[model samples]
Target: MRTQLSIPVTALAVIALAACGAESGPGSGSGGGTVQPDVPVAGVHWTVDSLTVDGTRTEAPDGAHVEITDKGRARGNYGCNHFGADVSVEGDTVTVRPAEMTEMACGEKVQNFEDALRAALTGRLKAELTDGRLILTTEKGDSIALTSQQPAPLVGTKWVVNGLVLGDTAASLPAGAQDKAYLTFGKDGSVRGSLGCNRFTGTAEISEDSIAFGRLASTRKLCDGPEMDVERKLVKVLEGTATYELNHRSLTLTGPDGEGIAAVAAEIPGEK
Candidate 1:
């Protein structure tokens, strides 16, 4: 003979409830379901929609955006200034340390936007991505809403130097030297450009966030004192460049010792 043991209906129901609760323990969804994965924030370009500080919300001025790469680097335009910094992400929290930015003067409105943006990014913030939008909320209740978009391409674009890094400082081109310093990257990995006073050609090796110029050949024509000085510094910095970042229409080249160049996109012929 065989004996069958059956559990009571109430006890079985309790057991089922316990198992369900275990599956949706701490950090689970509101309905006691599995926790959703953290939203991906890296390697995406974001355009600012609104930035709220304290309790007041302000629309982002033109040209305000942020791009965070998978390599833990962040670069953006703060309406008036271009900035870059190292970004660290852990779970749903992101921390963007104080960034280095160009000191371009802007109107009062743009300046205020920059000030608020800089303050918002100074420390850690809770990050949430929903409906293709990124929301960064600081512990103090400041929030920035950004819409994700495709970033501008870097290759096959002409760039005009707007500022150059000399030692530890960034300086704009000489007063009369607009559009004189430029760089163009060809489809064949060749770089041709003017170093303010002389035409230069070189082989450039470019990777996902980096660029290195090989032995460069340039015209030997001599120029004025200021132009020559600009050429000398430009050549040195280009030769030493190890990495590059492109944000909107701006390009930043960084060298081994924190030296770099900042350039804006130049309108080139036959290119839309």
Candidate 2:
């Protein structure tokens, strides 16, 4: 289960706060009082939980999340497509400019959810922070609920390959190869997984910024072209030392020539 933030407010402080309410006396303008700190919204991995609009609540898909940086950048996935936008925060208001997103064809359900999320995240929003949750409400009363969470650790995570990265561009896996390749890193300096066609196990030297994979031994198996294509690409990434980045539940391993594979942390069955 996710953890919630706790803040203790004393009775005397509450009483004093009430007493410092607006004054009706002459020339009593807004000036001095205990100013509450703005909510810490940046640099946190926010898992979008749901969107509430017109009294209806819709739960977000498994991988929907948003992360805002202090450098005026906002990047996140809306169910299927990943998006980025320029954002500005003033007091408790967050203004999001129009976002640029990837053009991926999605199923009906995911497309609908993505459209709703895209619409709700635009323009200026009032931010309300309570416990560990952050709610961003649009002027028309629509709201998006999100919860904070730490990034998934590299080791012990089931990373399922979702796309291939060549240089700076990301491309989807070959047809019929989706969800067929996966990798898991072990604490005992071992790595093992399916290569979409064959099963392999090998040693790995993991450091703070890179992973050095040893020669992998795999079972001899024949597969179709699509599967073989995925296996070959993954093999390239698994060879030699590769730098890695973990963004929320997403993982990217890039080889020396900037070729790599992108994966996501998949839930192990019966482990959640």
Candidate 3:
């Protein structure tokens, strides 16, 4: 995700965005009314409910993630690399920071997915951060939304993985399989983690409000450690539950009914 712009627009985003779905942007999202195509400004997050990438229209968890920080501090993940960009916000006028990213190769269509997402975030976007949720939008009614849910406080806490849904189908990690999953939420939304295995990141949108998730990203090292079973079972469990609750030292996950499941993860030191 290294973006050293030769300038802005066209050159940098155009090519990068092309790899993302059928759209090409590296486009811009923070521009004015007269802002040209694929150019953006900084510090403005628009609010649109639905969006279409390339020719596909995705609701629910298939939306966007945007951030316009206070200290030129902006960062987000477009279902891909956690991105860091420069930004400037003035009244209602918004501008984009010179955006850049870290280079971590992933097997999922993450690299391509990011390119398309960045491209669509162009032209005078209007955004709102309400109740801790950040929603930014595009002219075509496209949108990127994010909720600030960080790692929950660890220490004496119990948790569980309920279910895992990839797209629409219910994917089970199986009972005998050593897999595991966890739930993390923010005022904005929720992120069901796949431990160290394949984890999916998605949110529920206006009408397309359904649970969404993705694959896991971790070090490519093969080990037969005990955590390996936790990783495997965690994934299976996530695909079973629809929702969960976390307490000081416990996590309870409700599956298709009130009789769901729960687990107490040994809160890692400093896992807040």
The window of 10 residues in a row where model 1 has the poorest summed lDDT is 1-10
| Residues 207-251 of candidate 2: C-alpha lDDT, one tens digit per residue | 888999999999989998889999998998898999998877888
Assess candidate 2 and give its lDDT. 0.71
TM-score of 3: 0.38
TM-score of 2: 0.69
Better structure of 1 and 2 per TM-score: 2
Q: Candidate 1, TM-score vs. the true structure?
A: 0.48
Best by TM-score, which number? 2
Q: lDDT per residue, candidate 1, 214-258, as tens digits?
A: 989999998886677777767877784468877766787877777
Order of candidates by lDDT, top first? 2, 1, 3
lDDT of each: 0.65, 0.71, 0.40
Q: List candidate 1 stretches off by more than 4 Å.
A: 1-80, 83-151, 166-169, 268-271
Ranking by TM-score: 2, 1, 3
